[model samples]
Target: MPSQSLAYAVLFGHVAFIVVGALMTVLSQNLVRALVGLIMTLFGVAGLFFLMSAPFIGLMQILIYVGAVSILIFFAIMLTQSWSSGDEAQGPSRKRAVLASLTALAPALFLGLTIIFKSPPSLLVAEETEVSALGRFLLEPYILPFELISLLLTVAMAGAVILGFERRKQR
Candidate 1:
């Protein structure tokens, strides 16, 4: 077990990762770089889950968000050929940037102020459930929905690929 100070330091580092990654994701002109930033943010969230002693959730976060979702976004970007265009080079107008910044800042500032002013409730210890039980539950009653979602995703990917091929053939 780590010391309290060490844990706080780790928590701060994870928060920093989330913040920096979020900024990169929102502000970067390059689609690939934004995707990398999104990955970083997902990783930071996973780290937080691990810090909270939810290893299963942390692994799921990495497996689903970092691995699956990021790849899906990357493939979507590639299929759309959005990154190859030079339109982003022109950049957003200063007024638009200011508006976007303010739009993001408002919620953050409100949340920060609420946290600072409000007295937090006592933390409750969560009951620890075995990973095997959770797995069994997911695989049993939820299996059909799970399989359906997988099928849907597969079909979507196939459709995207077919559309990409059609586009190529047209050009």
Candidate 2:
């Protein structure tokens, strides 16, 4: 009933929403449902970042994940034909999905136990340092990577055009 408890409750809700949304996205067979779950997860993560005092990161999360990444994915999905040949290729493979779920769980469980047992030093206090640190790294140590990504994007665009426009030789 107290203010602190209310804050904790809200934070827990965000965390729960994020976890559920992420799992739904991963598990869903339908593309549109997965996209919806991904969007929910993105917004939930943005809320978490905001609570962690990185408002800039929250904004970037929304812009990069929801605005750009999702749109790019949606465009690719749109370009594909919706025809399902007999049994749909888009349907989930139960065995592969189970195997993948188990594989992911192993690492997650291990990392969780390690953190619990090792008891890493807690900051107990975190402030908004993400933007400055991210900016410095982007302009400094990661400048080459940034330039390489740009070059890669250019190459990919050219490749897409070549694939899209190429005509097969007629016999």
TM-score of model 2 (CA atoms)? 0.75
**lDDT, model 1:** 0.87
lDDT of 1 by residue, 2-94 (tens): 587788899999999999999898788898888899999999999998887788999999999998999989997887776726556567899
TM-score of 1: 0.72
Which 10-residue span in candidate 2 carries the lowest summed lDDT? 81-90
Clashes of 2: 0
For candidate 2, the per-residue lDDT at 61 reads 96
Clashing pairs in 2: none
Residue-wise lDDT of candidate 2 within 1-171, one digit each (tens)?
597687788799999999999987776666667778889999999998888788998999999999999998877666673323323346767898789889999989999999889997876336768577888989999999999999998999999899989899899
Error of 2 at 77 (Å): 1.9
